[model samples]
Each structure stands twice: as structure tokens, then as C-alpha cells.
Target: MTAALASENLASADAAIHLGNVSKVFGKEGADGSYRAVDRLNLDVARGQMLAILGKTGCGKSTIFNMIAGLTEPTSGTVRVSGKNPFSDFDAFRGKMAIVFQSDRLLPWRTAIQNVQLGLEMLDAPPADRKDTARQWLIKLGLGGHEDDFPHALSGGMRQRVSIARAFATNADILLCDEPFSALDESTAGKLRAEFVRLVKENGKTAVFITHSISEALEIGDRIVVLKRPAMIAYDVSFNTDTSAEERTLIRGRIGEVLAA
Candidate 1:
């Protein structure tokens, strides 16, 4: 592997999410119709780390996301979450991981609190516990009074907040987000991003946020992994809140160059 790939595959024994030499091919491999979306990609997300994966559309971002989410298996290599294979051990992850999709994905008939309780319901949590957990998350996400409102009655931003509250209500240790805030207006998205980062930190959750937006990645990730076609890592960098603005600007420029190439 190249030095960049080596860095991309940095060893982390305590990694919350690990993908080693993972490749995903749709259709028959080496056949005419086969498509390799991910090619020997390697990544390690340490516990409590918020990783932003940036790439253009059709760069296999969703393929990688599905693999990590245990929705799809890789054609080769291994995908492990908390030291277990995510694909083979899907059921073992129940209540251990949660996802926030691009769309709010709330059921129109369900109230905000009811939507938030969905995950808890899947976990078979007690009725009282589910209600309490859902209510707490809604309040934390600034939807206290809106909890009883149905999805159609809420604004776009409020619906997304309910989705986020749902994800956290499960008390999952890992979060997989696919441009969850991308649909909202910039101001709303920015606020949600800040709230997301804060909640992830405060809850000590490891998150992999997939986005095509460089600005979103820069704002949310302590570690940013920029991928090229076939989902190979092109650049890997880490920065924190204490990072200098000048340095961040330089990193942003570098990422732009990589993507432009």
C-alpha cells in the first residue's frame, strides 16, 4: 500500500469501526456486468472519533456506508465493528448502532415522540422507558412542545431534529449518518451540525458522517477522509476545535485540490 493508504489503514486495536482490505462488487465479479464500488478500502475509526467521509456522488460513499451499517456484505476482506464482523454479526448490533439518513424518514402518521420511539420499540424496551427516553431526546433536541405533533405538521428542520432524536433515543454507541443535514437550509444545517457534534461528543459515540460537502466535513469531523473513485482514500487529516483557522484553510484547499483531481 502507498503511504497515504497506510495512513488510511492506520492500526487501531480499539477501533470502533474497522474495514480492512474491503472491496464490494455488485453482480458477478470479473463478469461483464460487475461493478466494483469499493476497492480494497481500509479505514479505522477509534472510539469516540467523529469521522467525515467526503467524496463526489457515485464515489461509492453509499456502498461503504451500507457495508458499515451491516446492510451489505463486502465481496472481499472484512468489516468489523467493535471487533466483530458487522455483516455476519448484524443481529449482534441491535441497539448498538443507529443511522440518520438524508431524508428525515419519519412516518407521517406518527407524532414526533412516536417517531423517536421507533428505535426503542425495535429494541423491545419497556413502554414507559421508551416514552421517557423519546421525550428526553426530543427535549434535548429542542422539540419539547412539538413532541405530540405529527411529522406533516412539523417544519423540515423540525422533522429532521425528530429523526436525530430518534437515533439518539436508542442510546447507540455508534452513529452512521448519510448527509442527514444536507436537505436543510444552510443556517439550519449549520446549527444542526453543531448540535450533532456536541451530542456525539457528550454521548461518547463514534460516528461516521458521509457527505459530499467539503464545508460540512470540515465543520463536523475531527478526522476527515477524502475518497476518490472506487472509494479509495485520497487524503486523511485530523484537526480539532483548537486547530488554527489558517491550518484549516490550508487543509480545505488541499481537499479541494484532491477532489478536483
Candidate 2:
């Protein structure tokens, strides 16, 4: 078999997240008023892989994210996480999947550590255990002394650090990030991106990060999938830390060409 075909089969057999012939429509199918956000999109992400999905605005990136998060049901075909329907078995994934959004989304009234403990609270973890886990995550994210500060008292980067701490505190196996660092200044975003990639690798988490920036995707993803309008995969490539800079530049140029098309 072709190497690409063999790899595809391996992904299908052991994917942590799978979308098979998945399509999502906002209104009735085959109707004039309806809008199809995804068109028979099939994707497979293996365990512990970091997949960056690059797309233009209104290309249904968020729609695909929602479907994977179990917040939206597909119009046809199947969406599976660890071999189960995330939408139908939403409760089963409560502590198994965590999301980090563009905004920090921290509670105003809660202190940094408390906010980090939010997910653990849902799991009914003991208060002491929750506090310890939250504190450790905060420390790891460089928020060591700021754990007592409220959201309003922190800077944007610091607040997003707390958000990252919260997501990791749950120890979820799968992390879905929707441009989590997009709102920060370039310097801060760059720092956080490096830290995010490190944490994901260290924790052995499967991540699907959606981004509009090709540079960010290149920096964060081991495998990058660029999408066109209607959420179709236009280009897919995989690279690693061992990949040479020249190859990366070529990949970037190819991605730019695809996006421009």
C-alpha cells in the first residue's frame, strides 16, 4: 500500500477523535434557506497528536469545533470521540475533554486558583485535592504568586494563563483550543504558545487547535490541516521538531498558496 494510504488506515483504526462523512446544516437540508457548514468532512486524530486546523473566516471552523465538543449534532454521518458519540454521550466526556477559548472566560468573583479549580469542582473532588491541583497548575503556568488575585486584578496574559491552568487542572486527555492566544499581544502570545505546546507534550494530551494564522499553526502543530470554504480539507501535512527549517519554509509557502486559492 502507499505510505499515505497505510497511515490513513492506521489513523482510522486507532483515532482518538473521528469524523466520518460528517456534515452539518444550520437549517433543513436541501432547502434554499439552509446553510451547510461542513460537507462530508472526514478526519482522524491519533492519540496524543497535536492537530492544528487552519482556515479563513466563516469557513466553518467553529462549527466543526462545536460538533466535536458535543455542543452541536451533525446533520448526517457520525462524529466520534474514543469510539463514542460525543453529543449523545456528553456526560461521559465531562472530565475527558476540556476547552480553551480565545477569551479567558474566567469568573470575575473567583480568585485565580478558584477559577482553576472549577472543573475539579464539577467532578466532586475533595476541596483540598482541588485546591492542590489548581495551585500546581497555576505554578506550572508561571502564576505562582498570583493565585490569590481575582480576574480583574490580573493582566490579559495572566488571566489567560489562569485559563490554561484551569483546563490542565482537569487532567483531560483531549484538549480543544479555539485560538486561545489570539487576543494577546504578539510577545505574550508567542510565549504562551511555546508553553502550551510543552505542556501538551508533557501531559500526553491530544489537542486540536483552530487558528487563522499560518505562523501560529506551524509553531504549534505537529500535523497541520488547512481548510477551504465549506470546511473542506485543502491541504494536510505533518512535521516534527526534527523537521528542517527549509522544509518548514516550503510548507509555509504551500499553505499560503492553498489559502490564497
The number of the candidate with the highest lDDT is 2
Candidate 1's residue-wise lDDT over 11-44, tens digit each? 6446899998999999999999999999999898
Q: Against the true structure, what is each candidate's TM-score?
A: 0.95, 0.96
Per-residue lDDT over 5-42 for candidate 2, one digit per residue giving the tens place of the 0 to 100 score: 89866777789999989999999888889999999999
Error of 2 at 98 (Å): 0.6
For all candidates, the clash counts are 0, 0
Model 1 clash pairs are none
Q: What pairs collide in candidate 2?
A: none
User: Candidate 1, after superposition: displacement of residue 143 in Å?
Assistant: 0.7
Q: Which stretches of candidate 1 lie above 4 Å from their native place? A: 1-12
Clashes of 1: 0
